[model samples]
Target chain A: MKSHVFRPLLVVIGLVVIVLIARFFYVPSDFGSHEKGYMYGWHRKGNEDEWKAFKVKYQFNNEYCKDCHSDKYETLARSPHAVINCENCHGPAMEHPSDPAKLKIDKSREQCLRCHYPLPYPTSGRANIRGVDPEKHNPGVECSMCHNPHKPNLRGMK
Target chain B: MITRRDLLKKFVKTATGVMIPLAAFEIIDPKKLFADKPFKTDEAKVRWVFLVDTYKCVGCGLCVKACKTENEIPYDANVTRTWVERYVVTKNGNIYADTPKGARDGFTTNRIDLGMGKKQDIKKEDIKKAFFVPKLCNQCDNPSCVQVCPVGATYQAPDGVVLVDRKWCIGCGYCIMACPYGVRFFHPKYHVAEKCNFCYHRINKGMKTACVGACPFGARMIGNIKDPGDPVTKILMTERVGVLKEEYGTKPQVYYIGLDKEVR
Candidate 1:
């Protein structure tokens, strides 16, 4: 009777250990759904702090983001947008970074379009109709030429 | 004796199991530091390259100012991303920076962080004129940041362009640590990894970047190395070129034309 009870309990414990081990490796470590919306990059995993570090550290971005997304930081640092925080474009992302791919940060062009297509950016000092002149210029034709991340101006980069 | 391969495998396994986020700082791993593979990169894409012509450069701060204004970058507490660096190599082999003049003319001193990295050496222009070199992203084939990224947020594309996918990014700033050029920056708002995409959006649509379009000196050039007959191809064939910190084996894509060894 004692052996029977011990064996079943041992089997349950073994299964739990196996599950934990599987979670530690095969699982992508990061998970969660970010519903913060584009205004804040709602997800928390891939966040704004990473973006700023990328801009501040490098002279010319050498694609530092690859392997773990050093691309945005690398490109923006060299481009005109290196000044602004990544959250401005991506939105709140505290939930996604820790959980891996739980959030879809760059799934569509909505976040970029908010500023790139003439939206009244709700950020502080950013509500001055500071949006893109989509009618006049093709964002597809070198958006970084005129706009910046820190102070994206429509008058073109002077 | 425990083989090196066994040690490496042990390290990777240990590292993967650890999964702890580290603060941004250069950690010279003994395993990585001792690797003898020169230019032995693990990157999975073609690398982007930049070729800056120091001789043709006109000490204009257009690139610097443009980079700031376009990036919305706040006034520097440290350095400027891309700017023209001017140096004077004299006839007697006395090297000097014709600054105050160069700074006034935007020839150099983008790093407002270090007394603007400025040293005044004004003299007659005829004795030794200043030559400008533009500093920006080298877009190395073997990037330090890529190797250092604990996660796979940063990646290179097949077209040789470096890019970031925000979704997988963790904002760890590891890439910020390993870079020798000091080109990467952190975003204030997103708290995620962001950098130069070669104006990938525009380039994909067949257009040049702002600096390239605004360069009045005809100094900046963008190219597709695949097209052998391109202007960059022609320049590469005839011009003298150099890169920064070659000892790191990063294989920087940015080439300096008419580079002076004494500039460092």
Candidate 2:
């Protein structure tokens, strides 16, 4: 090859080498397209483990509470509120009965009113929820005081 | 001297000589050439699907609160993983919508601020129709957020969930901007890009997503679309469903029942 041709080829080779070296150092070893095809895009293999090991705060199912509070669990199971999880109102049980020793119970009127508040959204299926006019329904009082959440039936209201 | 045809023939022979072996190796073991790591779940067998029955949603905001608590998002932060928007369409064809505090403190008033200086109360008689629609990360099949992440921090998992790698995220806010649904937000404390992942940890353990479990009115649901008997799959197969912003062609996995045309 001529001198000019050789010089340009050498320069291109050097640049390619530099780029390969940079990629080797910059990209993590565990990084690559994995499992499925490249449609999902490249990601570090270790990140999946990190996300899998992530500690979720909410006790997703109420079955966990059944071991500790069987009585309340049974009562709630039989009631219309069976669909409601125990941790939803009491807050997430991330490190409960150990770090805090107790879950803070939400006994505020606002908490109960979240579902019970009367709003005329007829199409939302909220009309079936048995809403009340907060002003007329014993105002300035906590609902848990009169109505037990475990047995939310009106016949058993305290 | 080599003729032009002879030179072309030589080049073709050399190309075939190199290509034959590579094609054979790819055909023999495509996985060996393409994939580096083995996925835990059967990627083909698991397609996570989400369903929202807008008709059943009472806009209690428990799902928002549950998501915040489950994901460790700060309670006071205005950004949220999931939110509920109340839409009020009046008699005169004016559309009004608002998401007050991400509906964390359920809707307290019927009057919408409309981003005006003062809140205007829409009279009950004048209202044509009103409804609440919950919004969350759609987990699109071809997610724009995943496409725009400069560092490849955001990716769609095998199960159709778009996840952000917090450690790898450069916090350029590119993914935040790319998201059509405006679901991505900076983590209040970590400052990395964040959005809903369908509560991956809980769902993997056979529990419902936080938002689904939190909804008292049975408005939200999650199931594997790959399974023949999965409720979400059944709903998708049997019911009339709609997705938001179909014109964008993101192929969102989240399905909506009774989705109103007024909802964006």
Candidate 3:
């Protein structure tokens, strides 16, 4: 091969090496910085777009959720659970109200495990397990299936 | 046909909608309390509810006194961890609510208005006619507090108990906004959202709630809806019971049997 082609090939090879190295050490899941960026920064949607263009990745406004879900907002405002954010359980609903059809709200048991999955993290505690293994517990069988959120744990409750 | 202006417009339109809240959720996750119960209801065998008959109320403030003594709630704070508000309605469309309230810890005869309370003069005959609404957590079927709990802290149990995981809660103050009945509040010492747990500590051990046991009027009832013969189930089937804030779609478990139509 001519020197011109040979030199260009080496440059491309060198670029590939650099890119690979960056990807390995910089995968977003490891530090979660990239995931945060992907979730929050680079993925910003337009200010006044239609539901058709709305994506689950779109940023949400609590006030917007409070618009339709005002009752939840009022009840939760002073509740003991008030410090917790709505997205932690509902799982990022910015896109939910926009199209609702396309936007996923994490309604499944796996979704509940996002934070509640009783990890060995030592902070969640084994006693906090409430009896079952968070890893093996299936909400489909029970747990949230019968419980009412408005008022909880009354007399003679099973 | 993509005009440069239109293309820019579309691009900009699509950008901002996705950015703001995405950024917000990062910091907000730590603050959520979960209302794990959905906005729907399934028939429960052991549905728990509370009933306070206005006619039975003698304005003695016994329940109020009982609540403060039991919960050790601060009286000076003017926060009823569970207290009664008196209302006096007259024929004139004039209503004077929260009149002559009392408590175990220094409750005044003064008519202190509570929670968007109404103050209107009624006919002299209408005086002392208002009933007591033993206000606390309604424990709705579709409880708004549970709906807004970001962390799933204030969730319903499998057997139909709306309990908060006081341990995992971050106390973001969202459920306070979510509840229409104005039941829950921030505990000053615990610094988390707190309300009537129906005396779970005692009830779990087969004892009744303090308020329930203390009521001399037999106004309150407790039972498992799962049982065919439970009193609450019987009353729900036999008597006309009412729930507070029904218009908001929160199907409260606390049923007011023999509740007056005009009672708020």
Candidate 4:
């Protein structure tokens, strides 16, 4: 190799070696521990605990209630309230399986009013809430008195 | 014409000049320089789908409020990551679409007190039909937002959630304009492109999106479509679901059931 060209080539090789050594020292040994691909190395921080902790604040899904309340679960499945999850009204049932009394079953008039309350929203709107003016319809009467939440069609009226 | 001593001094000066910057850069650590970490989850292993049951949405605005609070969106800004539109079609074929405060505050049609003049006059007898449709980032399979991002800051994760790397985003607003659904917005405080990421930080941890969680009615749902046993797959297979702007070919992950013919 020519002397001038050889010297420049040697310098370039030496620089690359230095860079590699520097990288070895700088980069964390476990930097890509959770990485699935090379294109992106930074994975979102947090183990499974982050999501698990967040979910506990919300009501558990209907499937969890089905394990014990299989009869009520089956009945609700075929009823108009089938779309409603068990925990939506009963609250989160996470502790119910372990301690049966932990489930707070709310059978209040205010609970039914959440969806069925009188509002000016269009009937064709999503949810199509058939708004009922409580004062005129049934004053001081609980919703469950007239219509069963499980089967809202008033099956027992006959 | 330069002397040998002069040549050596010149070479040494240049060498020092190059070495100083190199040493400084090396110590700074290039690996830590990355703006954000890539998604660690295996893409093919997860197929996320968002199901919007328009027939079930009550227009209560709880989802919108939940999203704003969870994401810490600016309260005063008009921009929204998600919103609801109440479409009222008059009997005379006149259509009026309005979203009061992006539905962050629940809607009320009683215009007498709200000072919405003449809307009350045309209402009771002239209205044909009305409904509420919630809107959010579609998380398109072929997202234009991702395509227009000059920095590659907006990208689709392997699990198919479209995400924005705030650290990497340049706030160019290209992604905001590129979106067909008008989901992207420049956050007032952060000065970055912002939109619904399907609550990725929460979903990554196996929790539902904040909006979905806040919905009192079963109006919103999320599931892995790739799983045959997933309810989303079964619903998609069974329901007469529709996507927004199918002609755009974005293949939006959000599927709407009971979407009216007039809804865009």
What digit string (tens of lDDT, one per residue) describes model 4 on residues B10-117?
Answer: 997688556554432544345753433344344477868899887678777767766776677887687788998777678889766777778776564433222254
What does candidate 2's lDDT look like per residue over A1-158, in tens digits? 45888989978965765565566567787876665445465788788778877787777578888898999999999999898888878888857778568888888887877778766766777656777777788999988888999999987699
lDDT of 4 by residue, A10-50 (tens): 79976976776676665444333133232322323232223
Clashes of each: 102, 0, 83, 2
| Residue-level lDDT tens digits of model 3 in A70-129 | 888776665533533454345334356554544434344433332243212111122132
The prediction achieving the highest DockQ against the true structure is 2
Candidate 2 has a TM-score of 0.83
Q: What's each prediction's TM-score?
A: 0.49, 0.83, 0.49, 0.62
Candidate 2 wrong stretches, greater than 4 Å = A1-22, A135-140, B1-43
Question: Which RMSD does model 3 reach against the true structure?
Answer: 24.7
Across B110-151, the per-residue lDDT of candidate 1 in tens digits comes to 222224564444344323434556667666766667666665
Q: Higher-lDDT candidate among 2 and 4?
A: 2
Question: CA lDDT of B257 in candidate 1?
Answer: 72
| Model 1 chain B worst lDDT run, 10 consecutive residues | B104-113
Please tell me what DockQ candidate 1 reaches. Answer: 0.03
- Per-residue error at A141 for model 2, in Å? 3.2
**lDDT tens digits, residue span B47-130, model 2:** 888899999888889999898888889999899999999888888999888988899978766778666466878887777888
